[model samples]
Target: MNRLARQSLLLAGLLLPVLPLAAQHVDHAGHGASHARDPMAAAIAAPSRTPANVARDKYRHPAETLAFFGVRPDQTVVEYSPSGGWYTEILAPLLSAKGTFYALQPVGRNLDGYKTFLAAKPDVYGKVKLVPFPDQLSLIPAGSVDTLLTFRNIHNMVMNGTEAATFKSFYDLLKPGGILGVVDHRLPEARDSALEKTSGYLKVSTIRRLAQAAGFEYVGSSEINANPKDTADWEKGVWTLPPTLRNGEVDKARYLAIGESDRMTLKFRKPAS
Candidate 1:
């Protein structure tokens, strides 16, 4: 063969392998860029979301809260005790195209409600997985989840005497450096821990201590759900606020004006080791 032809053949062999690698690099970078783009905006704006849930967005601040937790569409997430699937309505569809969302509910009457909600909305929720929340929390494998979220449910756990255990379970379920996003009614500062069992509100300091005791590092907290209007003292506690209005029609208008209870949003993480 001529020397020029030999040189041409050798050059073609060297370029072939690099072409595939260069294409792979581009695809990888593009995937990460797209993942970093917030999906909450589009998810919250989805046409399929329930109107009732949409109405609560003003108070719940779903988009801001999730963003604070650094939620992404590509992580394996577990929503602990998603009673009635309020956030589920947003999460299921948001993660439907890319990630896994487990609707982890405690074994109880509300289990059927979660099931029915997802069943009725297959297009957006069909990809969701229903996982039971047993007392031991063994349903999930240890160090398997990327994120664990709980909303307005910690007070109940404190009342039931399961708050510590629940936090420990959350710690166990997460992989190293995994996140735990917690949102709950906020008790006024200096409130006694004893009152947490009765009043729906819990002190942010107390919750942070509890999480730390469970081996979670306190990353930070947010006031996205905070309502300074909440005086934190009511004849009926937080239930005296809107939505619940435990007093019934006795002073409904006053409660409506007060709005929902002030809430604390916290983000914690398991140690990388």
Candidate 2:
């Protein structure tokens, strides 16, 4: 072949391998560009969130709680048993732009209510993926989630005798190095497992043991949701504190002063290996 023809062939050969990589970069950028500019901020500011939900920020500390778990704007997060979508209001909008938020619910009356809540606010919650968790968390795919969060729900799992299975499922669903953010009513001291069931309280030691047994490493704990005033020995357990005030308006003022239960916020991780 002539000199010009050979030079052209050499240039083409050098560029061939780089073509696929260039295409991949463009594809990734395009995908990311389609997401909201700042999902976390947008979610927090979403107008569709109910006023009552916003009012609870003082006790729930949604932003700080999620931050403690290292939740990123772009991640696949699954919230276990979002019965009333309290956190859903924040998560759906925050993740709607760039990440996936899965609301896992069991089969019950709350399921219909949860669906209706999402349907009513399509602009903010339309992207939320609802997974029917039922008994055993059959809906979550193994090693698919970056973060798995459960709020005040562990005691119920223990009460129903599915605690171990549920933890195992959580372990299975997370990617290696994935985070598990657990928030539950705190028991001042370790109590018998059965007694804990009735009190809606759990000891940090017991929680750590359970999570470690399921192959997760206890990374750390945060006091972002702690309320020192809560003695946690109410007549109706944690529910007697605020929101629930199981006694109705009997001690409404007292319970209102205490706010919500003193909760333990913990972070655990699946080993990267």
Candidate 2 regions with alpha-carbon error over 4 angstroms: 1-38, 135-139, 190-193
lDDT of 2 by residue, 17-68 (tens): 9999999999978756654465555566667888988888899888789999
TM-score of each: 0.83, 0.83
Clashing pairs in 1: none
Estimate, for each residue in 1-273, the C-alpha lDDT of model 1 and write its tens digit: 999999999999999999999999999898666655757777887788879778889899998999899888988899999978889988987888889898889988398888888899888889998888875466678899999999999888888988888898889899999999999999877777677888889999988989999999999988899998898978677888977889999978888887888999999999999
* lDDT of prediction 2: 0.87
Worst 10 residues of 2 by lDDT: 33-42
List runs of model 1 lying over 4 Å from the truth: 1-38, 135-139
Candidate 1 versus the native: TM-score?
0.83
